[model samples]
Target: MTLATVESGFNGEPAVFTAELKPHRSLGPIGFRVLMGLSVAVTLINVVFFLATNALPVAMFFGLDLALLYGAFWLNYRAARAREIVRLSRNQLDIHKVTPAGFVRKSQYNPFWARFDVARHAEFGITDMAVVERARRTTLGKFLGPEERDSFAKAFTAALADIKRRV
Candidate 1:
């Protein structure tokens, strides 16, 4: 059940750490479509009943509600496209974040100089993980659940430690 993969780097170098992090979405495209269809069907049926009772205003409100629901799901699906990729080689550590709007942000650090830190709460378990180098700190695994974050932190920490021992 490993979520991260390590591969050989360019020029025959080996990868030290690599992870692809994405937000969990409970509904897939088909499930979302089905849910939306069912909701719209029910809303339309209720609106038809209201119209028969001369509640035209209520029917209009139902339409508005459906529109809003559609917009919300659209935005959610868009955001689900966001992802974070982290890769560490013997020389460098790179973090790339891609947002829903297709904006990309990249950060690089020296593997020997960087430190992996995990912030945790007693009851809630792990909260966040970050890579710190000199004056800069970039958080990782913001989209991961507590348990996932904990697992990532352990594996990442071990990788960093191995690098440190070799250097």
Candidate 2:
């Protein structure tokens, strides 16, 4: 199962909830940090090349490189907010990349029939990721941290079991 946090509103106060995803994997915090780190390293290489060749073009090249990097990061940010993936099999819906926890769905959930559901997820602290539960699908939680995914899984499975018993 996957784990996530959910919250609403932006005035620094809002309702919060926790969520559980079926089971899935996604690039975590480490991945993003690595990607950014690599880009910076490549920029350094470009600087070295420019210095060695005495090619004034290096400045322009660097500028272009920086621009591309900026765009990439900006889009990644957007994607993180876009709520990339969500899939539901049963009454329960598995939220994908439910931010603040980096949740990925694996199995399935019956939305209506299922008695229990994860209506909330991890807290929105540094990552601002919080999973919200909806009968249908809702766009929320896009960014994620490293350890949250694991936590969501445990919570989600338990919720499912509880729901089944209630039903």
Candidate 3:
């Protein structure tokens, strides 16, 4: 549940691996603020120009456009809060998925029985990954990009192998 637990190992066993995955966003909070400020300034300048040219409707629409742009960025930031956490130890593998709205879903598996599976594409690299245990399968790293997914798949597979060897 916490980074401390993962770092210290699960239930006193050695920690194999722990990964907290989040979606990549190019723009940070300050960047977003700066971008919005510039957008507002540009919109205001255009609006004033339209008003001076006797285009009242165009000026109103420019304000509306700025509002819509702000709303879009707000939604993007909200969605960026989503994350996936995976932890593996000698005996257990735990995965937690957290949504932007703060809902958390947890899945557990015995390290010996669970397999880290990846579906690969010749052109696109890793297309999907999952934790499979007999008949049950839980998808993972859906928010990660292709390169991140590939890196995660390699590390997770190695950790799983290490855990299995110890058992």
Candidate 4:
């Protein structure tokens, strides 16, 4: 029943973890490159459209918005990359995330004997989790990386297994 984080990667004593991304949790580097490229292309498209319409101010506004979003995405991606969360317990798996706007927390509880499950939200996207289950549940990440959802899911599932084995 312990949670331990060492840097971006964490190990739980209740179970004990050797931190690394699991098979299901791994995302190819190419995906991120594509995402970055798409984001820039999208922003450029908006800029071009606005310029063609002769709406300088509107174009600038959109540019700023896109820039901010890009920054957010880049930051999140980096954060995710730098940190690995290893779960080695089944009592409580609490994951806390911080951002400029605020901090978000995602956790899972594993009863002595319970199955783990991940629930998908259509609105949240299939790769991203709306809810993660152990014994009961808690809302997962609010702003988890959409492009990195598959990787997250695999990692989360492994964490759940680690918890189950410990308890």
Task: Estimate every model's Cα lDDT from 0 to 1.
Answer: 0.82, 0.48, 0.86, 0.52
**Candidate 4 lDDT, 61-164, residue by residue in tens:** 87898778768766665555433233435454444433333343434444344343455677755543433343454434434465455566676667666556
Off by over 4 Å in 4: 1-90, 99-108, 111-117, 120-137
Which parts of model 1 have CA positions greater than 4 angstroms off? Answer: 1-12
Model 3, span 3-89: residue lDDT tens: 334333336666679899999999998999899999999998999999999999999999999999999989988999888888887
Worst 10 residues of 1 by lDDT: 1-10
lDDT at residue 160 of model 3 (Cα atoms): 91
Pairs of colliding residues, candidate 3: none
lDDT of 2 by residue, 5-106 (tens): 322211242212244332233656788679778877887788788878887687568868877976876665655542434333323454444443445433
For residue 128, model 2's alpha carbon misses the true position, in angstroms, by 23
Worst 10 residues of 2 by lDDT: 6-15
- TM-score of every model? 0.89, 0.38, 0.89, 0.37
Q: Which ten residues in a row have the lowest lDDT in candidate 3?
A: 1-10
Model 1 CA lDDT for position 22: 90
Evaluated at residue 147, the lDDT of candidate 1 is 80
